[model samples]
Target: MTEQKQETKCITLKGSAVLLKEYLLYGINSILYQRGIYPPETFEPAEQFGLCILMSTDPKIKNFFDNVLGQIQEWLIQRIVEKVTLVILNVNTKEVLEKWDFKVDYETVSSNGNADDNGDGKFIEVGSKDTKTIQKEIREVIRQITGTVSFLPLLDCLCSFDILTYTKPECDIPKDWDETDPVFIANSQEVKLRSFSTSIHKMDTIVSYRNT
Candidate 1:
């Protein structure tokens, strides 16, 4: 039996930027243009989006293009997004940013308006530490982000998206999926979390989780 060589293309930062451009602009611009706030002819989704990211990387390269192609991220969120996510998948460009970097990253600087959370604001604290509440809040965030991204035309432009979602009603995860979270063994082979939500998060081990 001979295995065929897989024609896999490298996942680079450029690919991520390309996807980001579409997901961040077209859907938002289309709605804004219909609202008559921004002129129809002036609303160049692809070009504007491409220029925004390009401007961030190299403002000098665009020369005078920077003046016409000002970055507009907050506008997109204000017009078309109830929620937003910055997904980075390595495909072409070499310099990938660190985790949680986008949490504070912004294209347009606000005029003495805010410095904390980069204007995203702190997540509201929901009372009750029950597992149901945790799951509900997480699911709500997921629902919002998914809804936002569904309008994006370039969702298929990704090699893969690695995710870790945990859900359980007494361990009510997807039952048929024959996948288990990674675990490690110590001297006590039969070790378990002493109680629900009582275990410490380890560097390289799955910790048991519960609402209580």
Candidate 2:
């Protein structure tokens, strides 16, 4: 009889608190989906959507981002939930709270590598973070982690403290949701604006999830 050895699972993102702080904000503004919208097979360059990201100097906002990012990373690599590509940030409290303008496109679209002109080559307000650089960086990061596994398309959406996730035709189950305990969030949509911390660090993990 041959004895079998069990392989230990690696915690790549947990040890480092801000798992994706160093990453470029490409996926933040893009969504992904398979070519046929089915499963297992997708097209090249992938189907994409727009998204945004924002943060404030508020302690609660800081805590929220940390918790959300950490949980998502745990699911992405550990649980292999592949969905979402781009994200957008909305630091302007008034705009988000009062107006609730969550749309991703400002004017037009373009095919050029520049996501800033956004494939339109036209002048626009609030452009993306330059797709040329961010896309390459994203692919490199994914390759490092996923190796050669296929991932679903993600349509980047407005990044807020609210419950945002990547999904498919079915809204019930997110395309890349974690299989862990239910995450109870209270007053998640409400947020306070602030500046980026000195640096993304481990000391910034969120302990409380619900209304605290």
Per-prediction count of colliding residue pairs? 10, 34
Most TM-score-accurate candidate = 2
Q: Which regions of candidate 1 fall more than 4 Å away from where they truly are?
A: 1-9, 41-212
lDDT of 1 at 200: 11
TM-score of each: 0.21, 0.25
Cα-based lDDT for every prediction? 0.25, 0.28
Model 1's TM-score against the true structure? 0.21
Clashing pairs in 1: 11-90, 11-91, 12-90, 12-91, 12-92, 13-92, 13-93, 131-211, 168-172, 169-172
| Candidate 2 wrong stretches, greater than 4 Å | 1-55, 85-163, 167-212
Model 1 per-residue lDDT tens digits across residues 169-203:
23332343344442222221111111111011001
Question: Model 2: per-residue lDDT, tens digit, 1-212?
Answer: 12221112111222222223333122221111211112223222332212222223345644655665555555432323323222222345312211111111112222223233246654222222333333344344333223211332231333242334343232345455453322333443322111111121111111121122
Most accurate candidate by lDDT: 2
